[model samples]
Target chain A: MADQSQPPLTRIQQKNRDLILEGALSVFSVNGFRGATIDQIADAAGLSKPNVLYYFASKDDIHKTLLTTLLDMWLAPMIRIDPDGDPLEEVMTYVRAKLEMSRRFPRESRLFAYEILQGAPHLTEILGGGLRQIVDRAATILQGWMDDGRLAPVEPRHLIFSIWALTQHYADFEVQVRAVLGPGHDPFVEAGPFLDNLYRKILGL
Target chain B: MADQSQPPLTRIQQKNRDLILEGALSVFSVNGFRGATIDQIADAAGLSKPNVLYYFASKDDIHKTLLTTLLDMWLAPMIRIDPDGDPLEEVMTYVRAKLEMSRRFPRESRLFAYEILQGAPHLTEILGGGLRQIVDRAATILQGWMDDGRLAPVEPRHLIFSIWALTQHYADFEVQVRAVLGPGHDPFVEAGPFLDNLYRKILGL
Candidate 1:
């Protein structure tokens, strides 16, 4: 989404952009795309509306830019699964990595969830094309493990879906998860062994 | 949330209320609470804004009424897991029931997801009180099963969280799930055996 034709941003420019994006994420994640406004983003970013607009053309531009960056970050965990490595360890690593991300980056997780909950109007192209391609590649690798009997034979895509569902819920549904788990308990820690057991069983480890 | 002191609604009153709620669900589920408007609900319900106002005191009223009803319906599935029933069967029944609800009531699923995504501002009392109580009871039942070795030993609360995460993702992230699966495949059908395997393993059947 970066314009190659433009000159590289100076550090000050880059910092301002990051500030705006961070603020925009706060607004967009909680208020959602339709609900968020430039004024709100500007206020959150500690900039004037004109300054925020000076950085991005419009609210849609900010959202699309945020999602573009997010999809890449989202994919990095999946891409960490090394096909050449031992299958169960690799899968658990991926699962743990996802859980860690949920713990660390809940706001980003909610931003993505909010997008899909509203039908991914800003993200359809990436979800259907780039996202699906990475998932298909991962499926192929998972199926290869199954074919060799290194993992349990299950539909690879649904397995992928399950991994995503199990991990992201910690972030996207943090409020409910925390409320239900009650006080003084860490959800990610509690989730660790259970996810390990299920994945290990599913992988035939 | 129903007013016990109020007289029962006539058939016409009930029908109109249903229409407004249905229309509100369509709007609120898609646009979320901060984004939705009474005018939009009025248009979706085929009533004037004044008429929509006459039935519900405000947009907040419509959303609260809808979510209050949704919580009861949501609890019904968990309540169906009879404690005296075979623990594994009861758990699977609850799992399938949740998945089926995701398939049959995606809008409702997303509405609930959106509410939680935005911090459960309207549903906090229920989440902290009523909802937690039912989940605690189920957790107690699950723990009893584990103590008897009728199910696998794991944190019952985390196991319940896994069930919700895996099933609701189908509805909450339907757009992404459909895009990844591509054309023609029924997600619920594909998800059935996969979830069955998971429950079977987690329950140590």
Candidate 2:
């Protein structure tokens, strides 16, 4: 597996780790967590399962790494929503940011979708701690906007959920969305204008 | 299993068949399609799996029945969005109806969620045929509204997606919503005012 690991992984360790994870993401995203096998992941990485495990402890470990990584990316856009910024612009920023993620990292989005759809069984700790807390803070920001009369009155929390569902739907249900939208329809290009007008109308700013 | 199903289900037998299906819905909705089992459903119907299968073929059969049934119910409210009604009111009615289902029949919502999450493998045929067709028609209705300048000019399909995501989020993500909103918060109650004003703002009437 590497000539007794040749003094063990050092700087090269991080690069191989990233390689294995990239392969794992492609496999896991397509098949789902339970549906995926360690052997398949190893083969995809061009390493043995034990070798893969040598880099990461277990399948769960690999999954956790992928999820935490994706969660950081997912929440970055929401974290950028400035309570101090213009109301409609802030919301539009959030919308475009999320849609952009769907376009750029659809596989990551689908993998996250698979996890949540399965009830967040692996990342309950992350969901309960980091993700949930961030959503709450953002929801509070929206509430603050409503209170200041800078944003139109609405359920700040559900509004966020709508943003998430709409943006993520493009990825999670991409097959169905594409099927229904037909071949020529690019949901992202169509989606940006739709969302911009949506926020403008909802915020009424 | 029962002497050729005890002379086969008759017209009266057909009525009993409906009763078994009715009972399956209550059980499947609460426990989810997978969490639900033949035993729980049979117990709910005061019968055995063999007897249940006599009416329907398998657990998949029962779950498929529930899905098809709910699809009709789910689409009915949206279809009732009168083409001639006050356009804003029409959309608002669709919102209220969807939220009402989310509140009143969350089990149905979860059942659908679980099915879709599992890639709708079992119901892909029905989904491709029935559900997709219905959404197409609704999208057309929405386009009509946009065409008449009755609703804000947005991608009718995405507008529909947002409305769905907004309303269904209350039911589908109730646990997370409750956790963040605090234990005492009733999401629907909080959501009602949020949705009412949201539609009003978006419709701009």
Candidate 3:
């Protein structure tokens, strides 16, 4: 029988898991969860189907693992919004962190977007639990800022939504952004200042 | 052979076409273009495969038709931003119209979101040609407003992108919004005023 409390994954197991996840990310990001197939992921990872299954029980397991990890990374910026930090600086830092994530991890953004677009079937529990917890905490901090007159008074939740919407648009809607901006334009370069100006103006910072 | 450009579609033909498009919208919105099948669309439309094919040659054809019609409706709000109207009013009008579309036609919005998320393989031409043309024209008008000091100066293209992001986020990310807001909270009710406040503050209107 397998040991109930084994040590963490060995080096090879960790490497294989990483390989599977990286391959799954590419497939799932492009094809979405429903559209992607296990064979495709297995082929992408250069592993046999049984080998991949040894790491993940099924396609849903693989997808769930990816999504769980993604949620952690996706919300890290919001979680980092220090309650004790200066209001405007903290908000601005959060915005910058989100936009940088959009620029650096566009596939992850699109993967999440695709899930949300499909009504977040796999993410409902986490969205309601962990996501709501973090958002509520962040919203409380933002409200405190508003109450203390350190930031302009507005709906704190909506403000966070706006930040997410504006920044992630560059990543999730990259094709549309690039189409309108044309060939030579670097969207992130312009987006950084554009968003900074927008938040400043809106927050009266 | 069928006459090439005889009159417009017959009443029955138009009705069937609309039925097909409606079904396609629901399917594509949920499953995405690649994930959706003609049989599913036909079943959703309460028609046989042959009947569906009578109106649209293939799944691609049906998706293309839906996308083409959607682009028109999607951009109509932008096109209605009259150059002669009050700058802020025109911009606000566009924002409201877009938000209303999100509230009324979320499926359409998701269909477009799915296509865009997939790198817009099917929409490159329309995005580059029609979308770019209208955006360029709108950007010109927005730039004029800035030049005349009627509005705050920023990148007009980015301004449009922001409007798209903020407004469509409600529809495209409805699951997340609903999850965070919890039950019995009408997102659109708060969204209307929240967005109005945001744009007013940002534009210094």
Score residue A109 of candidate 2 by CA lDDT.
Answer: 82
TM-score of each: 0.97, 0.80, 0.95
Worst 10 residues of 2 chain A by lDDT: A1-10
Tens digit per residue, CA lDDT, model 2, A1-205:
2566456568768787988898898888776776678998998888888889999999999998898887888789998888889887888888999999998888898787666655667677776677778988898999898898888777777788778877877776666666566668898888888777777887775
How good is the docking of model 1, as DockQ? 0.84
The true-versus-predicted C-alpha distance at residue A23 of model 1, in Å, is: 1.1
Question: Over 4 Å off in model 1, which ranges?
Answer: A1-4, B1-4
- Which residue pairs show collisions in model 3? none
- For model 3, residues A123-187, the per-residue Cα lDDT tens digits are 98989998999999999999999998889889999998999999999999999999999999999
lDDT of 3 at B182: 90
Candidate with the larger TM-score of 1 and 2: 1
lDDT of each: 0.91, 0.77, 0.90
Among these predicted structures, which one has the highest lDDT? Answer: 1
How would you encode candidate 2's per-residue C-alpha lDDT over B72-123 as one tens digit per residue?
8877887787767887888888889898998998777767765665577767
By TM-score rank, best first, the candidates go 1, 3, 2
Which scores better on DockQ, 1 or 2? 1
Off by over 4 Å in 2: A1-16, B1-63
Write candidate 1's Cα lDDT for A1-205 as tens digits.
7767988899988999999999999998887888788999999999999999999998899999999888889789898788999988888999999989988888899899999988999889988899999999999999999899898888999999999999999999999999998999899888888899888877774
What is the alpha-carbon lDDT for the whole of candidate 1?
A: 0.91
